[model samples]
Target: MKAFDIAIVGAGIFGLSVAKAAHDRGMRVALIEKDTVANGASKGLLGALMPHIPSQWNDKKQFQFDALRTLSEEIAALEEATGVSTGYRRVGRLMPLYTQDKLDHALHRQDESQTRWRTAETGFSFNVVKETPFKDWPAANTAPLGYIWDTLAARANPRLVSAALKAYLEPRITLLEHTKFDRFDEDAGLVHLGDGSTLMAENLVLSAGYEGFDLIKDLTNQSIGSGVKGQSLALKLELPVELPVIYDEGIYVIAHENGTVAVGSTSERDWSHKETEEPTLQAMLDKAIQFCPVLEGAPIIDRWAGIRPKCRKRDPLVGLIPGHKRLWVATGGFKISYGIAHRIAQALMNQIDATSGTQIHLPETFTCAYHFA
Candidate 1:
């Protein structure tokens, strides 16, 4: 048997983020994956890092905003170390305001964003712009009330970023691909593998996404969360150098750098099979073409569907699992997982950073214990 400081299951962004944190903090880390990295929900094409509206400023919102602020640097650092790119860009977002009431609400959010998303060194802005200002996005005409141009929203290729992190950490940390984690002995810090081999660590984190939900159920015998299946489509379209992500109605028309626009996704709560792409995805594509006329004749290049974990409280589930001595969980980010995975991992690291004394001030409402409270 071999030993390390910590063992992480699930090579998705959440697990990789925690491994990176522990490794950076000079701890021995072992990351085990049941499948290939980023093959789950994180492998999709839509990497929208949209921020919460500044009006509803809370710890969860602030944490995401702060994480998005520094997310590019983290990806860049990993890219530098691994000689790979995450296709990350802060191209911002364009949310159309059709109804007069919605326009008024956006204008109010514009005021709140100035104070909520800004700092001295750098800041983000949300402005109500004329349709002419959007020289690149094609959906401006669909918005009867102009658009809300947010400079903070960004996008990154989830697969690229996850792979980059895995590559960088593969050398620094012990990574086991195709290694399934069975039930664990949290008190003893031991993780059992499917091949009948055992590994020991000082700590263990469950970041296995939806599968982690099942693991927790086995341990606590309580229903803590459920899976939400989502479907996305990638469209081959010709566009200019870059443009902001288009958020019109409930559809997202995202344009990447390589002239490929990705339009996603359907959040199906009551889904039976997550692997199949149903006819509803085509409806989304049709609606997207209507919303963005420029993509009228775009052809479908790829289709993706996966299940995301949603905690009972609906926010991210982080920190130690309630009543467990050494078992920690960092799953259930839902749609915001990519945008806030780094901060979630850091928060978990803070819980284990015994020598730091000063821990990251996570909002009390986001802690795992809060669900029971």
Candidate 2:
């Protein structure tokens, strides 16, 4: 029976972040993965770190804003410690405004961002402009009214970030790859593995993406989350790495530093196959090429499909499992997992250590108490 200070079941971004945070605090952490790390949605192509519109802000929105703002520093630290680049660049984002109503809403948010989108160290803008920074990036015809160049939005290569995290963690933590979690023995503080082995830990963290909900349901008899399928396509086309991510509707076109452009994705609640590319991706590709003529004939280098964990409340489910002293959860990040993962780790670690008064505040809506209710 191996022992650890903490045991995390899942090697997705959320679980990896938790394991890294726990290890950095000088704790023996064991990370158990059913498959490989970043095998699910975390490995997806689109790494758009766009924040919510600055109007009608609440604790949830503020939490996301803080995560987006502080991610750059977090990525820098990860890169420095591992000597690997995460392909992170704050290249901003572009939203083509085609309707007068939409442009009016953007203008209102632009004014609201002056106060809502500001931190003590820096501020980001959400300005509406008639011209794009690049020609035909988003053909002027797409934005008959104008475009919103949101300075806060950024992009990261998801694969590179995962690789950097793996590099930083592989040497420090116990990684149980290709191992499935059977169950957690709360009374014994033991995590039962599918191989009939058990690892002892003072605490157990479940960050297994959508499959995590099944574990919780088995324990508490409630379904709090389900998997939402998303598909993305990577193009061989090369564009300037600093180009702002062009986003319209559900389509995201982001140019990475590796000289590849990523376009995606479809949010389907009912997916027939988890990893099969369907016609929805083609439709999105067509629309993306329409928005950016430069992508019209760009050959797709890869097509990816994965399931994103979406909570019933539509926010991340974090914090300690109610009625269980040794169990914790950190999943249901869905689309914004990459942007908010580090902060989620901070909040969960703070809870585990009973260390409060930190700048990171987990929203009430993200709690298991809230989700269980």
Candidate 3:
């Protein structure tokens, strides 16, 4: 039996980030993944780090604002230390305004939450185009409306980011891939594997996404989350468009460094992993081409599907398991996993340290036990 100070299940961005944080603190860490690292939702992510305005987020806005701000610097540091270009670009986001009312509302929100909300003219630049130059563009219907440009929002390569984290933590952490957790012996603090092997750890952290809830339900008797399937595709474009990330007419188009544009996504609640409907793909394609008519001639390169762990509250659940002394969870991030993973991992480490009588403080919302039925 291999013993470790901490055992993390799931090698997605969340799990890898947590492992990296623990390893940085000189804690012996073991990360187990049922599949390859970043093979789950993290791999399928479009890697957009666009933060919602605090005014639009209502109560939970502050946390997101702070997390995004923190991640911007954290990712830069990670990129510097790891020497891996995660394709992080602060190119800003272009959100087109459809109607006068919508523009008024956006301006009002920006004015009301000027301290929290960033808009064009205030560090960011946006313009209202009378006509979109590209053919088959959707901006025709919503033409003459200006766009809200946010300078703080950025984008990154999800696969590169996940790979960089894994590489940086490799020397200090034990990564066990293609292994599934069968169950755990609560009394002994041991996790039994599918191969009839058991590993001991002083603390266990479940960042296993949707598959986590059922695995530990017998011990915790709690349903922490569910999965939301998202389908996205990549297209190879002929012309290189220097557009930042464009969110025109409810569709997202991000230009990648490889001269390929990635467009997504459909948020379907009831969908299976093996399911890939043409309509869904077409819908995304239509929206993408509508947003950028240059994509009309772009060759379709790749398409994929991924499941995002959508919690009951649509927020990440990170804390100690109820009625369990040595178990904790960091799951149900939905789409914010890529952007918020690092900060969430830091917070989880803080919880583990606080449990071990170490003084580390985290926000209450991040470390609270979420109620799931």
Candidate 4:
């Protein structure tokens, strides 16, 4: 049996982030994946890193805010190390206010953003403007009142980010693609693989998207999470690479650097299989075109659908599992995984590395014990 300091199940953004953080700490790590890397929801096209409403803030929101605030530097370092661009940019986000009530609500947040989004050096704006910076990026009629230009939001190419991390960690860690984690024997401190191989690890992390929920249930006899199906598509359209992400009524239109704009996604909880419905996908495309007329006749380049894990309490479930030694979890970021996975991974590492003398306090709600409770 191979020996490792830690074994991580899942190669999605969450698992990959943890593997990188652990490897950086000079720990021997093993990343096991049932499918190929980023084969889950992390493979989707829309990568909107928007923040929650600035009002009624809480620890969860603050944690996400700090994560987003530092992600640019993190991506820059990853790119420098691997020479692979994650296509990251702080291009901001746009939300058209269609009603007087909506516009008033947005106006109220401007002051809140000025206060909450401020750091010692800079602050992001939640300004409501009369028109978009570009013509018909969002049709003028879409916002009868005004639009929200929030500077706190940013974006990255999810696939590229996954690639960069893989490139940086491939030589530093053991990556077992096409291998499933059958179970673990805590008594023996070994992880059993589907191929009947066993590996010894001091610690184990289950970050296998929704499938992870099943593993947790088998171990704990409780339902801690569920899977939500999301569908998104890519359009072959040329737009300014710096164009702000357009978000309206649950539809997102993101312009990527490769001249292919992304439009997505539908969150469906009641689904049986992982398949895309043409109507659902077309409806999103039609609405996207309504917001960005330039995509009126754009050709569909690719379509993607996958299940994303949603924890019981709705926040990301991280940290050590209560009542269990050497068992941990770092999954269930759901829709916001791309924006905060790196920080979530780091916080879990801080908890795992007791000798480091530094701890990152996570929101009480984000703990695995909270979900189990």
Candidate 5:
């Protein structure tokens, strides 16, 4: 059995980020994934790094806001170190206001949360626009709706970002792909692989997304996560679009590199993790064309679906398991995984270090017992 100081299950962005953080701390780390790297939601994401500013006014939304605020610089550093363009673009976000009442509501929310929750240093900007600027877009539909431009939000190619993180951590960490974790022996501090091999580790971290819940169900005696399926599509547009990421009426259209525009996504909680449906594809296309008419003639290049891990309280479960000292969890990041994974991983590393008396003081929400109870 190969022993390590830390073993992380799942090679998604969350797991990879954790591995990198642990490795940075001079801990021997092993990252295990059931499939190829980034094959899960980390690969299928639209890579919108939009912070939930409206939700940040309340105490409940503090964790996500803080995580995203911290991840801004962390992601840039990671990209710089890896020399791999994560396709990170701080192109801002345009959220169209359909009605005056909606605009008023958004303004009120922004005003309420601006002081404490807004990330000004990271270029979080917002303003209402009255006109439809795009020549190919429908004037009748978009002209009436005022839009809010959020400068802090950004987008990246999720696949490339995950791949870059993996490559960056390759020399420092052990990556095991296509290897399933059967379970773990808490007392022995051992992780059992599907090949009937056991790997020893003093500490275990489960960043396995929705699958992590099942692996620990027998020992934990509770459901910690569930899958929330999302459907997305990519269209190769005829003309290049320099439009900021547009969010209107729950649908979003983001400009991608190489003259391609990515439009998504449908939040369907009842759907399974099966192949994409024609109706879903057409529905997304209809909305994309409605938002940006330049996509009318664009060819459909790729369409896919991914399952986001939704927790019971719709927040992530970080920190160590309540009763288990060596076992930890860092999953259940519903839709904000790509945006906040790096920061969450950093916080988890701090928590582990704190347990070992190497550091102290993490936010109360990040502690595992907060959700475990």
Candidate 6:
């Protein structure tokens, strides 16, 4: 039995983020995963790190903005430390402004975004541009209107980020693959594994994506979160300029640094969305073609699908699971998981460190206490 200070189940971005945060703080951690790393929503090809509209300022939006602002530097530092590229960049985003009413609303947000988003460290700006921001950018000839260009928006290679975390913490943490965390004997401070192996840990953290809901249901008999199916596609197309992510309707046209344009994502709440091609996906692709005419003849290299977790409140669910002392959960980021997973991990660790604990100032809406209440 390995004695660890913190034992985290699930190696999604959330779990990996916790492991990195804990390991960096000199805590002995056990990273447990049922499958290989980054197999969940964390590894999705479309890494749209775009910020909120910056209007109607709320704690959750502020938290996400701060995370998005600092993420580039944070990932850069990690890349320098481990020599792994997260493919992160603050390239900004462009959204088609169709009607004048929509343009007026976005312009209003532009002012609001500037007031809050602008700071010393990060100079994120919003503007309504007439001409295309970049050559070969998706002007979407169909909609002969202007675009909203937001400088705060960024993108990251989710797969690379996961790999970087694994590499950075490889030497410091105990990573268990094909290992299942079956049950938690909270009072005994023991974790029962599937292979009949038990681990003694001072505290436990659950950062499992959608599966975390099931784990919590089994342990507490409560359905705290559910999974939302998201489907995306990767296209093999070389672009001349590095364009910002083009978002229109539900389609996201992302031109990655690797010269492959990633387009996609249909949100399906009811039925299962599989990797197999279907009409819904085709409709999205058709809409995408209308949005980005250049991608009309692009090759569809891969289709990726995953279920992002959604808590009751629809924000991130973090903090102690109800009625449990040694157990804690950090999940349900849904679409914004990648944007705020690092901060969620940090906040969870701060919460777990009750005795001589470090101060973690998180939004009230993101805490589990509020969610369960």
lDDT of 6 by residue, 303-334 (tens): 88888889867888888888988898888888
Better of 3 and 6 by TM-score: 6
How do the residues 23-65 of candidate 4 rate in per-residue lDDT, one tens digit apiece? 9888999999999999888898988998988889889988999
Cα error, candidate 6, residue 109 (Å): 0.9
Error of 1 at 252 (Å): 1.0
| Each model's total of backbone clashes | 0, 0, 1, 0, 0, 0
Candidate 3 — what's its lDDT? Answer: 0.74
Model 4: lDDT of residue 132: 90
lDDT of 2 by residue, 5-107 (tens): 9999999999999998898778899999989999888999999998998899899999999999889999999999999998899998898999999999999
Candidate 2 error regions (>4 Å): 119-121, 356-359
- My TM-score estimates for the predictions, one after another, are 0.96, 0.97, 0.89, 0.98, 0.91, 0.95
lDDT of 3 by residue, 210-317 (tens): 877676566667665678888888887643444567776556788877677788877888875646677888888887776566778777788878888877767788
Candidate 3, residue 172: how far the Cα is off, in Å: 2.1
Which tens-of-lDDT digit does each residue in 71-176 have in candidate 5? Answer: 6677788888888878777767777677879788768766654565544654465555576455434334664666675666778888888988987988778889
Alpha-carbon RMSD to native, per candidate: 1.6, 1.3, 3.4, 1.2, 2.6, 1.8
Model 4 C-alpha lDDT versus the unseen true structure? 0.90
**Which prediction has more favorable lDDT, 4 or 6?**
4
In model 4, which regions exceed 4 Å deviation? Answer: none
Superposed Cα deviation of residue 134, candidate 6 (Å): 1.3
Pairs of residues clashing in candidate 3: 138-290
Rank order (by TM-score, best first)? 4, 2, 1, 6, 5, 3
Candidate 5: give the clashing pairs.
Answer: none
Give the number of colliding residue pairs in candidate 6.
0
